[model samples]
Target: MFISFEGIDGSGKSTQARMLADALREAGHDVVLTREPGGSPGAEEIRRLVLEGDPDRWSAETEILLFTAARRDHLERVIEPALASGKVVICDRFADSTRMYQGLSRGDLRAVVDQLHSLMIKREPDLTILIDIDPATGLSRAKGRQGTEERFEDFGLGLQEKMRAGFLALSKEFAPRFRVIDGARDPQRVAQDVLETVQAELPG
Candidate 1:
């Protein structure tokens, strides 16, 4: 099973992802926990460039290509083999993030991202969990943690709201495969909700 988690910055994706993996392991399932934009060595290098680099240097097209490149490396090195071995793969983020960030809400760059995703991740996730939160609240959580923001994280409330809408639209388009969770709750509660959802989807 390949399960991907999606959310805005500071939406508790990483925390929930780890918690999910731990719960699965405790339940006697083999699992691999990883994340997008930097899952493997090559992808990590690209991640640094894309996330921490000069915002002025990369155009919208360039940004899309870079994300695709990282995704390709991640798929080749991490996601595929684990799934082939019958292990549950829980990822922190995936292609949906690129679509939300660059395609729908940010650059109007869906065409380029769609083409790449079609060629690359032909098989979508068995399940996608979207942790939905208001932009202002999410950003505040993120700012509290890092005390500094990356380029994408710096995108103001308007863009973040649009991104949330994008995720909702995607959830509608993919019905049963998409699960949207309210992220305004406590972290433990959110994680518990994710656990229940995954258990319901993947029965023992």
Candidate 2:
């Protein structure tokens, strides 16, 4: 199975992704836990370029290209191989992130993002878990970590709010494979919900 987690910077999707991978592995599922912008070695290099530096380092259009390039490398080198070998691939973030961050944050470049995805990537997770939360709380949580990848977090609460709405909209648009989960609860509680949701969809 292929799965991707999506949400604003501090929505705990990454934590949930890790929890899911670990849980599945414990159950004897072969799993690959990864993240976008930096999954494979080549993509990891691209990750630093786009994720660090100033928030204004790259415009939306420029970011779209950079992210796509990274994603292509990741898909080719990591995601596809794991999936083909029957391992569950749990990814921290995926193209939907690009759709919101680079597509909506700076302008309406969603079409551009979609076009590139269809042309280059042409793959979507069998399921997507969107951990939805309030922008203020999400940003607070994100900033609390104080990691170096603060480029998006530094965009302020305004961008986080917009990204939250955008992700919710994407869930509806991709309803069949999208699962929306409330992420405002305690981490363990949230992981329980995530695990249940994923379990239901696991192959019988």
Candidate 3:
């Protein structure tokens, strides 16, 4: 099984992704936990360029290219091999992120983002868990994190609100493969909800 957890920054998707990977491993399943923009060596290098530095470090179009390149490296080096070996790959984020982030940043270039994805990284997770949370709370939690990857968060609350909307809309558009979970609850509670959802989808 391949799974990806997604949400606005601070939606607890990464935490839940890790929890799910641990839970699955505890159940004797072969699982590989990884993340986007930097899952493999090459992509990690790209991650630094895109994630750190000034917010205006790259133009919207250039940023999209960088993200797509990183994703291609991640898929080739990390995601695909694990899946081929029959391990459950739980990724923190994937193409949906690029779709949503770039869509919001450059509305006119949304189509270009889609084209690049189709040409380079034409894959999707077997299941996607969308951690739905309000932008206010999400931003507050993100602000508490200590990291140089704050470029996206630096977009501020308004941008986050728009991202939240975009993500929710994506969940609907891809409802067949998406499981939306409320992320505003306690961490344990939210993790449990995610576990149950994933467990139900697991084969006997």
Candidate 4:
């Protein structure tokens, strides 16, 4: 199975992704926990370029290219091999992030983003768990982890609000493969809910 966990910065999707991978492993399943923008070595180099620079270092179009390049490398090098080995791939973020970040909510290039995705990478996760949370709360949590990859969080609360709405809309648009989970609760509670939801879908 291939799963992707997505949400705004500090929504605890990363934590849940890790927890889910660990849980699956404990159940004797072969699992590979990975993340977008840097899942493979080549993608990691690209990740540094897009994530570490100044906020205005790249134009909307340029940023989309960088993200797509990184994603393609990740899928080809890391994700495909693990999935071929029958390992459950749990990724912290995936293409939906590019669709949200570069596709109008954060940037102004929705059409270009869609075109690039279709022309290059056109795959979706089997299941996507969106850890939904309020923008203010998520921003506060993100503030505590500011570092080199702070560009997205630096987008401010207003943009985050818009991104939240965009993600919610995406969940509806991709309802067959999307699972929206409340992320405002405690981490353990959120993890429990995430595990249960994912478990129900797993083949026993």
Best by TM-score: 2
Which 10-residue span in candidate 3 carries the lowest summed lDDT?
Answer: 101-110
- For candidate 1, the lDDT comes to 0.86
Q: What C-alpha lDDT, on a 0 to 100 scale, does residue 101 get in candidate 2? A: 96
- In model 3, pairs of residues that clash are none
Sort every candidate by lDDT, greatest first. 2, 3, 4, 1
| Model 2 regions lying over 4 Å from their true place | none
For candidate 4, which ten residues in a row score worst on lDDT?
102-111
Q: How many backbone clashes does candidate 1 have?
A: 0
Give lDDT: candidate 2, residue 24: 92
Ten residues in sequence with the least summed lDDT for candidate 1: 147-156
lDDT of 1 by residue, 12-86 (tens): 888899999999999999999999888999998888887774546577778788989898988988999998888
lDDT by residue for model 3 over 1-204, one digit each (tens)? 889999999999999999998999999999999998899999999999998988888888898999999999999998999999988999999999988888565566778888998999999889999999999999999989978899999989988998989999999999999999999999899999999999999867
For candidate 4, write residues 1-204 as lDDT tens digits: 899999998899999999998888898999989998899999999889888867788877888999999989998888989989888999999989988988866557788888988888888899999999999999999888867788877778988898899999999989999999999998989999999999999866
Pairs with backbone N, CA or C atoms under 3 Å apart (clashes), candidate 2: none
**What lDDT score belongs to each candidate, Candidate 1 first?**
0.86, 0.94, 0.91, 0.89
Candidate 1: residue pairs that collide = none
**What lDDT would candidate 3 get against the real structure?**
0.91
Model 2: weakest 10-residue lDDT segment is 50-59
Candidate 2: tens digits of C-alpha lDDT, residues 1-204: 999999998899999999999999999999999999889999999899988989899889999999999999999999999989989999999999999999888999999999999999999999999999999999999999989989999999999999999999999999999999999999999999999999999997
